[model samples]
Target: MRTDHMLSMIDDFNGAGFEQVDLMAPIQFDVSVRYLKEDPWERVRQISRRLPNSKVRALIRSRNLAAFDFLPHDVIDAWVDRLVANGVKVIGAFDGLNDIDNISRALVRAKEHGVETFGAVSFCESPVHTDELFVAKAQELIEKADVDAIMLKDAGGLLTPDRIRTLVPALKSVMGDRVLEVHTHSLTGLAPLVCLEAVELGADAIHLSVAPLSSGNGQPSTQSVVRDLRALGYVVNVDDERVDAISNRIREIAEEEGKPLGEPVEYNGLHYMHQTPGGMLSNFKSQLETAGLSDRYDELLHEVARVRKELAYPIMITPFAQFVGTQAVMNVMAGERYKVVPNEIKKYVLGYYGTLLAEIEPELREKIIANGASDIRLEPSEPAPMLPSLQERYPDEDLDTWLLRAQFAGSQVDEMKKTVAEGGNADEIPQPYFGLIKALYEKSEDGQQHLKFGDLAISLDKSK
Candidate 1:
């Protein structure tokens, strides 16, 4: 989630009398973090202070610790420490490969910090991502990582009712009374049904977003989910009026910003083949449009499928999704596959980021290596030691500012500071001119008014 949207969502939910909501904190390697004008951590800290009843949850990429590559233990420790200190209450840790070793240390640290640790299984489809594999991973999270809860994360909205019917039971059997949560997207238009199946089969909590921000590229609408759950004789604690208010506020903001409103998408058959999350799909479209190749989008989607196959079906999530999508774009533009493979793709093929679920075809692997792809060894760099560099670069700033500078470019950090100075708190809602006019109308006994400001003139009729 972007920092501003997240803060606004939190405030809206809180104002609606919702006791608690778990927000997905920005991932350490989130590209959005780099573009944000203000320090995301500072925003998080402010939200933590403003909404004491809410819980903040961050999605940790296991050993990667939110970065593209595996982080050293010290780095992981520092990241978790910062999150805990900033008031994050839950850490949802998962490895793309469902590798328990990748997740254990982070989960253990979160548990040590007294934060709820949810060991997540990154949901995907392939021969390797079998039901048994997910169950085994969940068992490892419980027995090895000792996580407080288990989460099934369907990042691509790939889970269906048929699959959930068996998968949920399989997971529940092994979980043995442990809290289980389901987090899925609405990309496939199956998330609501999948969520229902999960809850029916014993999921304790289901992640959802409020309407206007939910559905299309986001989670299913909380109102829709709660309505269905209640229809099925489930007890939904949320107030309908509050949900409506939050949705109305979000709708207004979306309209003002010209952002797309979340709506139920028609089922597309190709979604099963590509499994690209809605956000990534939108990004791919925007990038393609910017390059004047918008007409070739369908071709690029086909190329993505082909690329995913060649790369041995890495889960369609960050880093991997970016790698595959970027390569696909290049292939489509260059008119030749592997005409230009990115360094990230090369590193991925060389096993620098962890083992792929399936092996890259030897012929393709050879071609990439022949095209100047060499194994890049990663050095173990401790994050704490980087503080000195940050201190030197941003002398007058606090630790939060320094941290943002360390994560992003200095220019972006400066812009964020400037934005804050300009009274642009992401949490502050803009008062619409219509609201002022309505207030004036309410105060006027005649229910009509006329006003003029220099050359500008305005009139209002409340009766109309």
Candidate 2:
């Protein structure tokens, strides 16, 4: 999203009586800064200042924070402190592996900083992922972190109404007074019903997004869900008029940008098997078409299922998803499994990321070790502290800059700085009148315009 659109969404959320907003951590750091050359921290500061009645929530990717690898202790501490400094009031920390040990420290740090913490259980569907397992994980998060809430994060959208019926009650039973919030995608088309079922089963909260951004792999629509809740005799406290207006604005923005609007999808049982996200699935199709193997899409998916199970069922989320998907593609392309193992796969099998849900087969593990990168030790060890060395290397940079530098690759941050210095980012129109004026200025022969809106007047003279 454009920076202006992001700020406007926050304003709309506050106006619509929404109390919390999620800033996708990975997307902000990677896509916004690395890809779009925009400053995410500045955006956070702006949002924090603007929201008087809302909480600024941020997602923390376990020990990785916003990066792919497990960062050092000093880095994690600085990350939490910086988030609090920039107005993030709520932090939801989760490891893609659902490893509580990986996320516990970050959650504890956020709690110490007096920010609301949600210790998240990365939800998925597998023989190992049961109601009992989820309950145990939630209990573990509470015991270890003392988080303000527990989030059942179904990033795969695999939860069904039947599953929620048992899972919600199981989690709430051990949650004591703490809130149990449900955050599921609509990828399976069962999320709306699952959300209702969760609330009926004693879940305290449900994460939702407005229309145009809701449904079709995203969260359930706020407008529809709120209406359904009220119709079911729940006293939903929100401004319906404001929510409708926000929805309308989002739809208009989608139309203006030519972006695809979220829509309902039919339930696909195969999705339960592969569990690849909708966006990633599209990329897979495109990639296959490019490789002239489009006909083998089914084969690739089956290979994904096989690879996931072989690798002990790493939750089909990022880094893991990319790892498994890339290996699967290679396996298919090379016509041999394990003939070519990516270093990430090698690291994963070696327990470098963290504890796997289940152990990889002994023979397969040995094969992976043989074919993978030689630099990775046979036995994984804790990451060494790097803050001192990083600071020594760049003595002039602050902690914020240090954090970004530590995460991103060579010259990415420098390029982002260059783009900002060159004013390559989207221009801020501020108001509908300003948008009209900008349009008028764009059409002017000499790039000059003057406009008046009631008591407000503006003049543009780009020629000068």
Candidate 3:
């Protein structure tokens, strides 16, 4: 198959580049991502050879790059070497924390092979479980890696338009010439909006869903962005005729596989934030429908806009609909009434997909399905600068001193993590650790109950 990236043909879009850009149809860059149009290798080869001007990119997301399983690092080396030898430069990026190392290694190898490698970090809030460690690491990569570009992927459509505007510029400032692409999930009802905002800020590429393989099974459609960008007079190079054909084929594939065509394009007016928290958004979307807000979607949106602007925020995001999008959305979200626990890394796993930890590990699944979870809360309207309950519990016990205790207990806390996963009574675990969880619980709110590693059903004082 052909490997050269097709680039010469600007085709009909070559007429005149407009000063005002609409990212819905990014005239700035071409549509690419093998995950979407998995044309057979032969077809891909033909397309590669014929349409060298039409750049083809392979998404190293979950599909191409599975879990931390061993990928042929050397195979990728040779594959990329061959592709570049044949004139196709590779656009690859890291999505999960699990794959970052491998992809980063691949980028290094691709560069040595004389292949131009553009890389992007698939953005999400998960890695913050490491408490800004990943963000720092991302900055490090940009500073040292010499990657051709950085792509910000919104896999579940969690990014908001407000966020896109902020993140695009922030990333551009850091990566400069290397900031290559912005791929979004139409999931949040803001994908197109975000794309528009992104293009407005001078992003190099904006990825779109090519109709057929979009919006079923946890993904958002790129069609909305395409339609909107085109309306805004952006000259996107999409072959609209292929939209229906590809979309229909995907539908047939789902039916044959006995799965629902998960997310459908709807102007139901609920923010795509509904889909951010797994099944939570689907249910909320239904609730909004039941509220008979279908016709008054615009009004409901206005109400939500007002609520978002007016509501008191928490330290972390409560498991709510409004806090959708990538990690960049955290600053605004943490503004709500969610009290961020002192143990930021230990406490924040609300949106975590323990799916794999649950799968291939039944004991872990049973623990998760059983213990239940915690909620994030915010501050009070009290007059005084109230010391938090923890501070009040042991007066003169400095925050640093308390943090030192948590650090000491951190290793033992792994035991509590096991109890939640493998089931261990508090008594079976060490006694001193219980003292810590007991203290942690006393100072926290009702939603901040379970210390899982300590005991899920344990009452505020560590008693079940």
Inter-residue clash pairs, candidate 1:
37-416
**lDDT-based ranking, best first?**
2, 1, 3
lDDT at position 281, candidate 3: 39
Give the per-residue lDDT digits (tens) of candidate 3, residues 1-464.
01111112222112222111111111011111111111122233443454344354543431123221223443344444544444344546453432354466666766787655566555543323231433454565665457777767565565666666666666666665565577665554556666777787888777655444455333345566667778878877665545544455556444433456645554433443222433543544455577554454343344443333222111112222333222212222344322222222112233221111111234432332333233422211212222344367557754432322222223333343343345333333333444576567668765366445533444453343
TM-score of each candidate?
0.84, 0.92, 0.44
Model 3 ranges off by over 4 Å: 1-46, 61-64, 72-76, 82-88, 98-100, 126-138, 216-224, 230-464
Question: Relative to the true structure, how large is the alpha-carbon lDDT of every model?
Answer: 0.75, 0.85, 0.42
Candidate 1 contains a number of clashing pairs equal to 1
162 Cα displacement, candidate 1 (Å): 0.3
Best TM-score among the predictions, by candidate number: 2
How well does candidate 1 score on lDDT at residue 438? 56
Give Cα distance to truth, residue 178, candidate 3, Å: 2.5
Better of 1 and 3 by lDDT: 1
In the order shown, what is each candidate's alpha-carbon RMSD? 5.0, 4.3, 22.2
lDDT winner between 1 and 2, please give it: 2
If ranked by TM-score, best first, what sequence of candidates would result?
2, 1, 3
